[model samples]
Target: MARPAAKARVPKHLVALAVVAILGLVLVADYLWASSSASSSAVWSSRLNLHTGPAGSTPPVAKKIKEDKKSVGSTGINATFADLPAPELKWEEMAEAPVARLDGAAIQIKNLLYVFAGYGTINHVHSHVDIYNFSDNTWGGRFDMPEDMAHSHLGMVTDGRFIYVVTGQYGPQCRGPTTRNFVLDTETKEWRGMPPLPVPRYAPATQLWRGRLHVMGGSKEDRHEPALEHWSLAVKDGKALEKEWRSEKPIPRGGPHRACVVANDKLLVIGGQEGDFMAKPGSPIFKCVRRSEVVYSNVYMLDDGTTWKELPPMPKPDSHIEFAWVNVNNSLVIAGGTTDKHPITKKMVLVGEVFRFNLGTLEWSVIGRLPFRIKTTLVGYWDGWLYFTSGQRDKGPKDPSPKKVKWVALGTVCHCHRCVVCLFF
Candidate 1:
């Protein structure tokens, strides 16, 4: 039975204030959700499987995966690059990941991509390791982490041969071995210990910039999101710098960690919940705001800590927009993500929508759509297309199976992971 609205109230003024507080929280949450939509999942903290082909069209031969060394165009798919009606990934019974998991971030160490640490049903955070070889299309494994680290929303980046993972939260209320930075060597398959972060935090902006691993602008918990406060770990013999912590010009009105990538020799941060950050992340929880602050898409780039300039915002603020290149020969492509309140449902743990960003023009557009409503999302880019996995993918109206099950390459990898290295020359 439903309680009557009038009789249930404890006090008048208190009720009103509570309502206002609720509204404020909802509004800010909405704003954050609106401004950012994750291409990847953010449970710890957050691409589309975009193929370089016309809708219902076929793929061409000789595809190239864009890494720091190469630049390609969307050749056979569409030279002009027109957005296609979204397609729900076809869920297949035979082609699922050998193992099932979520909250794991994939870091590419040279030709091999490793999905490190994830959260599962209960105590599902395993040091389990899955290795994929793009050249041979093989899935193998080495040893697991020395200890289990299973928070989804951590920050990570690779410098040529090694992956530097830092600042993730585990249990409730942002608990941890906070301040943990794990460095994995691809050749030895060994974990080297680095100095812990200055504080315990998750979702910090991590990237390989100017040959140093830049770890900056992240939050600890409910309170305190750090500023420009940049710290770089200089690589020695492919190892991290002597001192883990250093400082840089802090971003003024610091905000929550948005999408951080090395772009054009500069540190580029994009949309997130708070507008304070020059850059931000994509979120769907803040949908109404997405509808309201329609023009909140801004790309903030910092050059050597001296310049903070805003490149054109997205045509509109599109959250949960994933990034990839349409084909081996294509420009950078941003695809898949939804515009809806998260916890979309306990049964459905993710959002579903497909959008793309143009690296060349700083524009945003909707291309293909998800086949089914999805939750727990990730778009893994390898070879020429992306392998959308672990997520519940929408197949379409007539054939909807919420769970996306596969290791198939639905699309291509982006222009070298959002930052450019340009072997394109």
Candidate 2:
């Protein structure tokens, strides 16, 4: 039977082919397929950006994003800033204004900067406010303030149209009255009184949070010092004057700090004069000792009133710094305040220097120094540029010349971290 099966005739080509030849062809194909697959997998992985999406089904699930809302910047920098709010710095030397101020209150609505209640000589605060238009770089004399507020650490907020000037101190003469809140309508250019602050408050850094105006620690009614009490003012009329003062969670430290901003649903308070000694005349007694700067390099973040997490403070110790005078794009910029104190210096007061902090990165870098001394005031930013209206240009007699608004582009703002890369490749 075996001999009969082997007797079948085979073609010449088939008889010449060895089993090894067939096996070799199979091996070559398998090797090529595997090599190609491995290379393709690596290439595809480089190109693949797979974010987990909903499972394949009629109803889908929403993917959870870890990032908070306030921290979102332009996705790729090419997106339109249509709905984004852009602030512009405009100087008003064209018109007749008395003194350049640092402690003034600025509010924005419809791209107009309404300035009020700044520091100057003889209790003079341009009662007649100035309105600046960033679009045309023009100034219009608007409504006059009913009262003069001097040396009052002021906090300001605008509810789309109306702006409210919140708690600040009067001066260091004696104990000052706990000032009531003043609200103004940017559109109508009128001022009215809002609900009284729950406590004697002043100079707290104020900012808008999730559609609500929040005021943080600052110099209170006692004197040129910041009180730790934090209060939030909410406006129901969409007008600042009609809002009510409701006490919110206080910062862990019960003393006024210079500036505060909202990030990650938490309030970040910068620095203030804390625990610095001062020498006085006619006696051996020292006053306002530890006038802050104790925690100059300290940073405090509050997730809630009950919990305050400490982040790295500024690399440098500057107290009572002008939070508004420094401009940072999507970051917080603050100008000089204090470093150290001596008989020659009351508290280390620095001018013209600027420091910027990125909440996302927790990074601090000195951005730029002003061309002229910008003594103090709130800083505003627009389109990666900085602008500030100085209270006093320097420690000297106020220049009678019409005050000029100063501005510096962030790229031109300074040399450090100021990137100048030409993209022509």
Give the whole-model CA lDDT for all candidates, comma-separated. 0.45, 0.47
Backbone clash tally (model 1): 59
lDDT of 2: 0.47
Candidate 1's error at 366, in angstroms? 2.8
Cα error, residue 308 of model 1, in Å, equals 2.2
Residue 30 Cα positional deviation in candidate 1, in Å, after optimal superposition: 29
Q: TM-score for all predictions?
A: 0.59, 0.59
Query: 201-232 in candidate 2: lDDT tens per residue?
Result: 55566776655677766654444444666666
In terms of TM-score, how similar is model 1 to the real structure?
0.59
